[model samples]
Target chain A: MSSILKKFLMALTGLALVGFLIAHLGGNLYLFLGRDHFDGYAKKLEEMGPLLILAEIVLAGLFLTHLFMALKLTGENQTARGAQGYADNSKNQSTPASRWMWITGLFVMMFLVVHIKMFKFGEREKPITAKGEEIIKAFNGEEAAKQFARESGEHGSLYGLVQKEFKRPAVVGFYVVLMLVLGAHLSHGIASAFQSLGVLRPGWLQCLKPWCVALAWLIALGFALLPVCTFFGIGIN
Target chain B: MNFTLNVWRQKNANDQGRFETYQAKNISPEASFLEMLDVVNNELEAEGKEPIAFDHDCREGICGACGMMISGRAHGPRAATTTCQLYMRNFQDGETLTLEPWRAKAFPLVRDLVVDRSAFDRIIQAGGFISVNTGNAADANALPVPKDNAELAMDAAACIGCGACVAACKNASAMLFVSAKVSHLALLPQGDAERVRRTLNMVKTMDEAGFGNCSNTGACEAECPKSISISNIARLNREYARAKLLS
Candidate 1:
């Protein structure tokens, strides 16, 4: 395929992922409303059953397509630059974020793997309610966990898992750092995606540039907030 | 002003290039960058050595022939100025300058500080012109071109095909150069006849020439001697998409 078409696919998938990030951050922010509200939201998503699986499939498709195009283009670009580079080449106008997009993108992908493993396939203990803990202390094994969840009138405790994970300083620190990397990636990616799609005019880009950066940080900080707040005992009680 | 020059000296495409330092002694600050190089070349020739080889033409910055990486900047440190137009006064008296040719897979080195930029000519030949019958120029104002379009076309047409955009880009992408050519013609009525074919053919030729894809870093615009806006790139993208959809 042509280079333009490759870039066009990259832009479309990237924008779609940005949309997913916005929605994911919105849903995750329910954690601030305390355990019930947050767990209830998780339960609602779980209740979607096959539809949720289908959504996950589509989201995965978008992410993989974006990743594929990024790798393909980066390799081609490197080859096109030739083997003998300039001895003292310096950047005139390209930003650090723009130049190091492939690095940041790769970091984000690694973070996603660890993130999904930690949250989606992580431990699902009994809810941390007083009665639930009492039941857990009173009994043992998976039956007691299910009994406690049923008695507490709650689904599996995603909120409890989130609190457990964020309480770790290492986990919180990892999340905060990766969130910043994500912000850096989006800083260039958002505006670049629009430019690639040819939807944004040059005049509009002057104003849109800052907004794109702001939106990038906004989403990153929003996702980072949950871990930091949970670690500081803000939403834990 | 005396300056230290560390210039890339490549005998040919197969030669492994290396930097050789030469002292430019007692040069006038009023001379253009090319003139300073000429002085150094003259000194070398006087010393029974082959003078440094570079490219130049009109020497007025309009021909797009003279260009080099001066101290890591395409066309030196001046914005919107070509090397031929960049005066020596911009640098410190004792400053050390490094000069290198435009390095890209599509641009092979021919000699010291001179690379073959005929890839650009090939791209132009692909579709950078309008196809009209052989005749006298059309009467002025015969085909009504909007004022905004005419001005924008003129702005895009200001591109001199200097290859500075390629020199400056991290990917060495020529999107800016190709876009300027594509936009200049695509924006006019005469170019309207082959607009679709022109955009497709030019972009295809650019890709086939081993130019990297543009990542919208804006480096090309920053270093462009003509101050060609990346808006032309955006227009090129739009034109390509429109043509693709229609075709």
Candidate 2:
């Protein structure tokens, strides 16, 4: 794809990921409302049928597009530098934002895999239970639930599995650390995506920085707290 | 005050390098980073040991000639400053300092901390100039460029050809440098004629030279002595697209 198209894809996918985060956090925050509440909410999502399937497909596409564009841009950047190292003379021309991007991006990607496995895949592997009871998840209908269950297991307790998994202190700690890294990555990435897309002006960029930072910290902390709270038995109040 | 220095040492470009620790005694807070290095070099010279060989041209901030990684940071602890302009006062006297050459696929070591950065010169040669011949253009003000465009172009032009961007960059990409040069000239009417050729050729040259792609990191701007804006890279992207599509 063209450079500009690649950049646009980068931004678009980034925005999609951000949207997913917001939704994911919203569902997760239900954890604070008590187990049955979260279980009920998850059950409703399960009932969404084709709509939920569509969203997952779209979400997967967005992730793939973003990753592909990032890899392409990185490859082009490597081509620009060629075989020689930049002279000391060019040192003054580099920026930490541009320099640390790939490293942070790689870390973020790794974190994403772990995150998806911990939550999405892990949810599939286990079943959802509220205070140790089978939650009636909506997710389309019994047929769709059966489909997911057949795919996952004879009877899927995704939510219960989520709770059990988060109950481990070590796992919770790892999740918290990864969340911090995600926050750092987004702290630069969000603003950077805007800059790359030409939508950010200097003055506005300055003004938006604190808010962006606040948002990143909130999401990271919010996700991180879920596992920690689960481990500590501090479920909602 | 005294400080511990971990400096990369190599006999030559072909030699394997190692870190050598040295002590700097009675260092002054007011000394520039290069000046501090000068003291160390002087001591080595006095001791009949070969002094560390590094590159430096204008000690002033204007020359993009001097740069080295300090404590894993391009141009030391300061932001938006060059090594020649970085003052020792910014550093703690007793702290240990790690110094090394800029590491990139394109820039290879010539000696201890000097790398051959001529790849940059090659990229520039590919298309860093306008094709206007024999001063055949209209009067200087005749083009009547927008004031904002002119200012932005100049801001991009402030890039001193220093490779701090490359060193600070994890991939060691030269997009910032290539983009700045392209944006600066492409914004002006005098450079309009060769704009398409310039972008395509320069980008091709940059790619052929082994530089990494731009990943939208701001590290280059942070370490830039001239404080060249990363916004220029975005502009170059637009220009490159236009060149590729329109031409």
| Separate DockQ for every predicted complex | 0.70, 0.25
Q: State how far residue B73 of model 1 sits from its true place (Å).
A: 0.5
The lowest-lDDT stretch of 10 consecutive residues in candidate 1 chain B is: B130-139
Judged by lDDT, which candidate is best?
1
lDDT of each candidate versus the true structure: 0.90, 0.76
Give the poorly placed runs of model 1, Cα more than 4 Å off: A128-155
CA-based DockQ, model 2: 0.25
> Per-prediction TM-score, please?
0.95, 0.72
lDDT of 2 by residue, B29-119 (tens): 9888888889999999999988887889998878788888888778787877889888888988699988888888788788887888998
The DockQ leader among the candidates is: 1
| lDDT by residue (tens digit), candidate 1, A17-88 | 999999999999888888789888998999999999999999999999999989999999998889988888
Residue-level error in angstroms, candidate 1, position B140:
2.8
